[model samples]
Target: MPTDADDRVYYVISDLHVGGDEQLGEVEALPELLAFLERLERTDENAELIINGDAFGLWEITSVEGTDKFDYLTDTYPRLFEQLRTTGDDVTITLLPGNHDHELAAYDEYVDRFAAYNVTLVQDDSFTRRVGDRVVYFEHGHQQDPNNRIEDWGNPDASPLGYYYNTLVTSRAGQLSDRGRYNWLKDVQAVTPTERMPVWLLSKYFYREMNPLLRYALVPFLLLFNVSAVLAVLAGLSLADIWSTPVEEGTAFLGQFGAAGTALWFLLAVNVAIAGLLLLVGIPLYFLRRDVRKTIDRFGVFETTLTVDAEEPYEKAARERFAADEETAIYCYGHTHRPALSEVDGGVLVNSGTWLKRLHRRDGAIGVLPPVFYPSYQLCAVRIAAEADSVAVEFEEIRKPSPSTEELTLTERLLTLGRKPDPELPDRAEIPNGRSATPPEPAE
Candidate 1:
């Protein structure tokens, strides 16, 4: 199916977890990424580079500042922009926000700071691009996480603590636990079954308990933890079965207590037990709940869809002015970290694979399973090529240098101390809507 025309249009990388611990030996991958950019600039003058999401770990920095961890990335970001600008001066650069760097919600700061580099920051998770004759939608795909249903962010009934826990602590913690390179003990500490279980159970109860009343309220907040727990559990099971060597029977039970003993041991154990129960109960509830059925109707089992009011006067005005169609265009998103491309009856659906690496290690006779580091790791990009007859699209990964054994050793040592550095923010004034003032240039 390869063609010369398809080769003419290329989509560059996005969601590079530059500062995260997953960068392991892949440090060399940075220059390779840059080189890839250089090659694109030289060979494909009309090519567009779209950084889909998680371009930076702003949220991670807020939680655990790892300057050195992100040092390579911070140093490279501005330069990356400058290089792109120099390459074509007219090349299109579109940046979307992922849960990791959702600063785009506050767009004014991003634009004012990065405007000189010609970067366009999108406001909402959803946007449309035109390639030839086709229209393509772009979103970070976090809304489908169930734990971060996106609708709950602005709901009136949601508590600030609930919102913060779901958006910041739980989601990020789950991600770290799922993708971090450390042993299973560290992963367990970062995200416990207890934390994930209650959130799942409560979310199910709240959604069913209140129905439409709490649809926007409790459901989103509760689902945040539920979804996270599911992912964490999946990751934990995979890690325990795969990379981890079997412990002596006595050590296995003791290890379940985790790092700390004392009263915390019993408390954690109880929480873990509760979480286990919730998962046991929640899995079935997920199948039985009417509200979940409704969710399934609106958004596919592993999908998310947002129906904006196109007929609204304000929306109409914007659509007309922006040359957008007035018809309600459905944008479907998913968080399975596996990129999907499909056409639905009325709109389009996309899956933005994770920015983390899916790393798996096999310890001789331990077992074989999905690597903790390997589940959703890949820097991917999608190009929507719309010609008059039909629309075609393709995805690609931007390969980078991986971490070496020595680097892993150093990372493990640093992580043991819980002293990762923070990412640097530009001194420019914050953007008003956390998006770029300029709309993204049309896809080529």
Candidate 2:
């Protein structure tokens, strides 16, 4: 059905990563997603639901063949697929391949298969649509990334660094965490800067694998060890007489001991202090030397910036790029997994963040062996419509009625310890890719 009217609506979202793995299938916000779809169906009948990329997560598949992923996805989430089918009846469903699901572009059958469900599969690298007399660019935005960008964009056999990362790190986490007390492995994909993955993996081991009593016992010692390290440094300075009063002023203090005895006393005191520190901190450091070193190496300057909570550089770049193109008034894409909407120059850029759980660390809270996965939902979708003179873009965080944490499994509740307070969004959206311009729907 072709619409000749200039006033059009585009409903965009990305990085659904449905059937991400057995564990991802469990924690996915399917209810919220279905609700979002249903709401869209009721709002705009001719709207196009654009799933920009990484929709299926075929790269996370360990054993399934390329072509069988659709069936696997359908089998894993029957209700979700059914909702998609129903929603497709009301709105046009468009699928664009991202790096994780690049196989979709390589296999034409995927297009036909989705078409059977009233969904349209786009094999191109990007798609453009006209809205309000201006061209709007829609792309997955993966090519800009060094790790995920493929040399041969649409080739299925071409492997990018991201493919290996997913296979080795992501898929491995999937397999191991699937067996955990909670199906928490799906959050592995939420990590950014990617360096944090190993640290997160270590936390997962401590929480899920280690003996509870033994682990709790180590917590106190671990904290004491930090204090011990600080004390050791102070002992070194004390021995050097950095804080000492002049010998003339300290006559009473030294008068109690002979000249040589004074020097010996200070040395003995410093040595004893150092010895105590060695017992408290040095012993644990000796035992966990390899781990401590690995932690230091990971955090010691190179790629040290934890980009997870940081605003994505790609979003800024995309906004600038869109601003340069005069004809295009809007640029919409979604690889960063953080929803955003902003005006750049005469144009605007929108990023549809992932449907998966997002972990947000607080402003200044550092954690001790924190949970690998922080429980959060940044589930959202972008609604784009033509206005009188411009294209109106809105980022809406999808909300759903969730059960109490008591209903959550034991492991799920355990994963919430040391988590940051719920992140606060500002009232104004302001510029490109910040918080939403309008207030997001209140949490249910």
Candidate 3:
């Protein structure tokens, strides 16, 4: 059993694309993050910080060129690095290269740049560390994705959409310049539309279709019509009232009753018709839309999966080569932007989730401004503690609060945005590493 003194905690974070197109939320979270680092400095002295991957959106800047990328990195990432350095002077910072920043795969440049900042660059897909008696493994989880799997041939370089876009269509420049060699193929092929067309079209369609003003305008009419329709149905059912009343009373009652019946019946029919229409037409449309979305999502999944799997052949070879060596407890990785903690036959696996804020389709019906939900802002970490004859693993979230609307002033907004970073709380820890360093006992 490993002693308590040997146990250690490590913080893992990923996908902090410091200088990408969507920098708003990250920028907002910066001050709070700085403060959080200060707090960490004051507190957790022994913990190492592992930045899983995609720290920089290098692919985005490749076409743009010099100084811009450097300026952006210096302006944003230095604050983050400086704080980490100040908080944990002895702390080792391990950075795994991810797809977005695949340049890290070329280790020399990364080592040179990040070493000065006290960040160690890890070029491999998997890394292992020991705390007490526990062996922990880390990898970015993209290997599990199908689309980006490295096994896929001729995928584009590290950019997110570029892989699928390039794979499915020939570049215009290639078509034009390589005419002689590819002329036969080009002559038979259909020209691909702009890569961005589908996304742009969907965004525009959703914005106009889901407009709140239209929903609001229809709401009152819908309500009034429904009410009238209900009353009309009730009146129609009350034929006795029409037949039994005196002349004067019957005349007045019949007029009101008939009107109500007519209104009620009209509304009921309209609602039924609408519902029927929806069932017959809207449901199919809904399914079609979902299918389209899934198709697009699958493209992304394929690229991610392919890239990871391609790298896996080498990993598998290494594992086999070292099969007779010392048994390892866990395997953890975070380069693929997927979060997972699972026990495997030989070891445990951990994937630190990404810090990239995923852009979801905006829905205008919910608010004055369209609501853009960022799906991937979560920051996660793991703790490994020594138990009797084993080690326990745990996960945590480093949550930050949303900015309050009451604080509208510039100073107030900054202050609100700068609230203390929440306590790094674990979600689940204590799932034992399944396969022990020792070989399993033979069948009893």
> Which lDDT tens digits does candidate 3 get at residues 137-225?
66654444444334422232443454444323323322343333212122111111133334433432333344557645754564554
In Å, residue 226's CA in model 2 sits off its true spot by 4.2
Candidate 1 vs candidate 3, lDDT winner: 3
Segments in model 2 whose C-alpha atoms lie over 4 Å from true places = 233-238, 241-324, 362-373, 400-419, 424-444
Better TM-score candidate (1, 2): 2
- Model 3 Cα RMSD, 1 decimal: 12.4
Worst 10 residues of 3 by lDDT: 184-193
Candidate 3 accuracy as lDDT: 0.49
- Find the candidate with the highest TM-score and give its number: 2
TM-score, candidate number 3: 0.58
lDDT of each: 0.43, 0.67, 0.49
The residue-by-residue lDDT of candidate 2 on 1-444, one tens digit each, is 435536667778898887655565564577777788778667644677888998878888876887898898778877777777888877778889998889999888898888877789999888888766667788887776756777786687978777887877777777777577555555788775477677666666666666878877876555454455555555555668784343334445665778876885565455547657666785777879988778977886434232322345555765676656656667777887766655555466667788776655322122234543444667777777665544567766677433325223354355455553364221222222321234334322
**Candidate 1 structure lDDT:** 0.43
Better of 1 and 3 by TM-score: 3
lDDT of 3 at 375: 21
Number of the top-ranking candidate, with lDDT as the measure: 2
